[model samples]
Target: MAEIKTLAATVRSGTGKGAARSVRREGNIPGVIYGGGEAPTPITLNYREINKLIYAGHFLTTIFELDIDGKKERAIPRDYQLDVVRDTPMHVDFLRLKAGSRIKVAVPVHFLNQDVAPGIKRGGTVNIVLHAVDMLVPADNIPEAITIDLSTLDFNDTVHIKSIELAPNCTPVDKSNFTIVTIAPPPGGAAEAKRAPGKLCSAQAAESRHMLSS
Candidate 1:
């Protein structure tokens, strides 16, 4: 479990886009908190503190204790809008959480033991199909990341969402069976050539030949 440091925020009395822009000009990020049957509260947080949390790479799942106007509240990041050109955060949305409440959030997936995997040793490439997955978990026990063991994977072997071992009280929102990661022969190699008919040296080469013939 990864714990996120808390930040103190001040309630914003002003509203509208103009006010938000003014807050940004002062190096503060404008945010709103909703859910749990409470009225949305407009607030402003330190941009530096928010950036630090984003750099930690588990912003969504990491539990945050937001000190809003001196009142401590637990919340989770719901959405954040970023500037397209500068790639900086422009606006943020947070969801208020209650103890024992279940919330759905996307958690990052990490691959472990890749170097020791049998497939990689055999010159196979590991293809990741999903980087994150939505899961419904308790507010307090939300896992920062879901790790999958690649130690036992072999060539042509795949690990699916259903195969992952999830943390307690966490359940995948994706009910359909789906592959998360798979080990396959490298794109251009003897193994791939043997697998495909006509003995093409590589996928790109095969595509080029087809294009020329057509």
Candidate 2:
């Protein structure tokens, strides 16, 4: 399950570009909370604190509890904008989530047991086509990351969406068949190496037969 985090924020009564700039000038980030059938609320959070979360990664899918004016709201960072020059957060949008609410989120993929994989042992490369997959998950059951075991992978093998182990309650957003990872043979050609001994033996037997016939 995805871990929940608490963020400190305050109510921002003012709105518009000028108001947002003013908030930023004061070392805070301007943002809004929408959805959950409640009127959208404008708010602000400490620039330094929110910056840490943004830089830490997975801000979009990570569940968060916004403590606004002493009132707590369960939400997630739906969208955010950054200052290209400074690479700092400019604006953010929060989406409220309730218990049992299902949302589509991209979960990170982590491969395991690579050392024992036949493809890796044979000097092949594991090409990861999808680093993340969008999954429909319950609000309280969001996964922090998805796992894929590569021990069964062989040379030229491909792992598709059907092979992934997902929760019974979770469903993938992608309807089409997609590849998660694939194994490619080495530059010298491992397949050729495997057939070299057989080919040589067959050729030697053929040469001996010709010699005897002659």
Candidate 3:
């Protein structure tokens, strides 16, 4: 499940380009909370705190409990704007979370059992096509990542979206079955290595038997 974090914010008294600029001058980032059937609430967050959160990664998918003047609101960050030149946060938008609500988020992809994979043992490389996948899941049960097991994969084998078992109530946003990962053969060729060892062993055994008979 996605980890929930608490953030402190306060109601913004004004709204507009001028107001936003004033908020920035005061070392705060202007933001809004909308959706979940409630009226949009303009709020201000500490610039330094928000900047840190944005750079920490997975800001969009992370759930936040915003303490707005002693009132707690559950939300997920929907979008944020950064200054093109400075790359500093300019504004942020959040979507409120209600009971039984579902939202689309890009969940990170994780791989398991790489060491046990036949492809990996044969010196094959794992080529990841999607680092993250969009999923629609319950707001209260958002998954941290979509896991793919590579234990059964072999050289040149592919893992498609349809083959994976997702968490309950989690559905991928993409309707089409797409390739997620591939086990690519090594440059010298994994197939050749797989075949050569058996042949070499057989030849060694034959030579040993001939020497013993002689």
Q: Compare the candidates by lDDT and give the number of the best one.
A: 3
Supply candidate 3's per-residue lDDT for 173: 92
Q: Write the per-residue lDDT of candidate 3 for residues 33-101, one digit (tens) a residue.
A: 999998999999999999999999999989999999999999999999999999999999999999899
lDDT for predicted candidate 2 compared with the true structure: 0.89
After superposing candidate 3 on the true structure, give the runs of residues whose Cα lies further than 4 Å from its correct spot: 195-214
Q: What's the lDDT of the predicted structure labeled candidate 1?
A: 0.85
List candidate 1 stretches off by more than 4 Å.
188-214
Ranking by TM-score: 2, 3, 1
Displacement of the residue 122 alpha carbon in candidate 2, Å: 1.1
Clash totals in order: 0, 0, 0
lDDT of 2 by residue, 50-88 (tens): 899999999998898999999999998889999999999
What's the distance in Å from true for residue 16, model 1?
0.7
Off by over 4 Å in 2: 192-214
